[model samples]
Target: MSAFSRFTPLVSVLPSTVPFVGPEAIERQRGLKVEARIGANENGFGPAPSVLAAMREQAGDIWKYNDPENFDLREALAAHLGVTAANIAIGGGIDELLGQIVRMVIEPKMPVVTSLGGYPTFNFHVAGFGGRLVTVPYVNDREDLSGLLDAVKRESAPLVYFANPDNPMGSWWDADRIVAFARALPETCLLVLDEAYSETGPAGSLPPIEALIGLPNVVRTRTFSKAYGLAGARVGYAISTPGTALAFDKIRNHFGMNRLATAAALAALKDQAYLAEVVGNIHAARERIASIARANQLSPLPSATNFVAIDAGRDGTHARSIVDGLMQHGVFIRMPGVAPLNRCVRVSVGPERDMARFEEALPEVLRLLD
Candidate 1:
């Protein structure tokens, strides 16, 4: 009737939680089918035909263990990014890679810097490793670069997590500013530049890969989950100096790469034309979301990511009402977990029908809330 008593002290004290409450869990809890799945930032447009075909081809290989080194995928990613394979480290996705990064760098009580209300999963990893989280609040709905720098310097932190085309709020900074922020950090602190939304960001938003690839302290994490429409594939990679990347080999799950998922990613990378088409669709959906928000008299923040965060013209409580109200109508959406940011509802881009469902639900939700 009781749990094992021999677990580590850190594990014993950690609260059991998932950083994001997914739509499936909501469906189970509320007994409502999600008719419009515009939450969790998933690309509802789905993956390319080439990607699905590649996965189907690899289906028979499920009986075999994936290549432990993930060589072909690494090589493919390296070639795609114009970096050598040595500079890349593949993991299930950015989420897994984040845990590996925290494990590699954070020790008990070590300080980890991040923007407050930034990526909560990274903070969850930091907590699991017993690292102290040093947070800087967002300034004007964007990550505070200068404040984050100050926190790192003040705490002499070993790691900092920043996202470009950031989540929840979907704001981004120009590449020059990010490069400058990365360069300004002390060599002792490692920067986790999360670029999960990189493919969807506007021009001038992402730095050239070369800008920080040479920095041993800089590791850029990206995923196939966003614009590539491969969230379920769980394929992601980290780019850093060859020396910096080898650290992952020390603690990562060597055979964690799924064979079919790797096949999907490889095919996705090869089909650049499909990626371009998806990005265009994402742009159009963002505009549609903005228009819907405007119609409801809510202010939509300019987004460079696949989602739009609309200011609901009230506080977190009101925003929660909107989120809950939409779910009641079988339309799922999300909002930020922290103050100020929570005043906005975050909606992911999807296909026309999904957008139409959201467009129809917004006014009704707002009307009920009003």
Candidate 2:
């Protein structure tokens, strides 16, 4: 039973770990069914009816491989965002594209800058590619732009990752500040501006496409997972200069996109009315989540994403207890992976029924903790 030993040094040294332990895995491990699935910032409101209809109509086309160029989706996204199709690169999701970006820029032991305790998946990708991660701590619950830029300069790091409407804490930076940060980075460094929560974010929170489009070093990633409720579809895209965007084609899995997912995205893009409607619901659900957190005596942070991170008024262990305690009652939620941030449990905005379940379960869980 000896193992074959020809794996690359990087692969050999990496630990076997998943970035996120999904709710399904939790269910299997703990033997409990999730009644309110709001842990991962998924849109429990679900995809628009038009998107669903488009997918169903194209389901019969499953036998065909998706266009490697992703022509139609790119065209649709370009028109939607007021950019040329050449400005876009499609991927299964932001996660996959992060890997591709890391591969394109990182070499063994090269420094990559990111916010400490920010979007673990990007960190995961950096580690997978053998890059040295230079982290800057959050300042006042937002990613420290100045610190990240300093780290990039100090380390001569070729790449950096920053998520606006960031995960775990659900905090954001205004567009002006983000553009300033991008403009300030050294031309030698590339910035991965993750905007997965763009649709849910407030106006003026996202920089207009033209603001940074001229910069070859900045890539903004957006997703259908949060606001469009297409997590299962794994459709996301990156926006950058045509030259920078074309780098994805060099290492990307051609024909890797799902045909139906492309159809879904095309439909989703065309259904702006439905998107606006879902965004309204997302706003309402954010308030609902905050209200519930306040009712339970926890302070909820202001959020522009589909989730809120509530300060549990204790240490990581106490916040963890709330997370575990909720799961025991069939309410699944998540918490930040590191301290200071981990003092809060993150809750995603779900439909009213899921919200009701969480509302009923939270007090019981807190009472148990007390």
Candidate 3:
């Protein structure tokens, strides 16, 4: 019954936690089936038929390992983004790349800067590496760029994480401001510009590849999980100077990528028309979610991602009650974690069936709360 005593100190002291409790875990813990899974910011509209077909075709090759170089995916992404293949590094997803970045730059007790309530998975990676997190609170529901830069300077932090079309709040700054923020950071600091929701964001919200590609300290991460509807496939990549991008190869899992996932991502990239159509559907669903919130007398904040955050007009407890109540009726959703932000509930865009289930369940949940 005795536990192994040889675990690292950091691992022993860290609390066992997940960035988000998945819907499957919720269903198991609460003994309820999820009728509508609009909580995880997944593209419930699903992947393009072409992507599915490609995956099916490649499934027969599952016994083979994916190319360690990730040649085809990186080359495809480079051509799509107008960059050289040497400027790219592929990973299982943004989450894995974040962990690698943290390990590359952080030593024990070193400072890492990020928004107070930004993507929790980045925070989790920082903690796993024993880095001290220096958080800057959101200003007006958006990640405070000036505040984050100030903290980075004040702490002389070597690593910083920022997300465009940020999670939890679903807020973003235009490309110009993001570029300025990146330029302002000291050359000693490495910036992790997380653009996982890039395809869903508005025009001019993403900086062009030419803007920061030459900066050695800047690494922009993107994923197939959102607009591409490939969350299950676990494909993502980082864009940086060729020198900086190569750093991931020194520490990354050489054969971590799945073969079929690579095929799906390649097919998804080739089908720009499908991406556009899904984006249009996503826009409509955002409006539908906002309308549902307004009909229930709650306010929906403007969102640049696949999800919308609705202000429940009270404290964390009240927002939590609505989240819980909705789940009781088989509609699964989530809420922000920290104070002030926690007054809102976050819902992801899905198909009309999921939206209809949410529309029917929300008013009943709120009525019960009333």
- Candidate 3 per-residue lDDT over residues 1-370, each given as its tens digit: 5778989999989898998899999999999999999999899999999999998888999999999999988899999999999999999899999999999999999999998888899999999999999999998899999999999999999999999989989889999999999999999999999999998888999998899998999999999999999999899899999999989999999999999999999999999999999999999999999999999899999999999999999999999999999999899899999988999999999999999999999999898888
User: Which lDDT tens digits does candidate 2 get at residues 1-370?
Assistant: 5766998989989988899999999999999999999999999999999999988889999999999999999999999889999999999999999999999999999999998889999999999999999988888788999999899999999999999989978999999999999999999999999999998888899998999999999999999888999999999999999999999999999979999999998999899999999999999999999999999999999999999999999999999999999999899999998888889999999999999999999999999889
Score candidate 2 by lDDT. 0.94
lDDT of 1 by residue, 193-260 (tens): 99999999989999999999999999999999999999988999999999999999998999888899
Off by over 4 Å in 2: none
| Every candidate's CA RMSD | 0.7, 0.8, 0.8
Q: What's the distance in Å from true for residue 205, model 2?
A: 0.8
Task: Count clashing residue pairs per candidate.
Answer: 0, 1, 0
Residue 43, candidate 3: how far off, in angstroms?
Answer: 0.6
lDDT of each: 0.95, 0.94, 0.94
Stretches off by above 4 angstroms in model 1 are: none
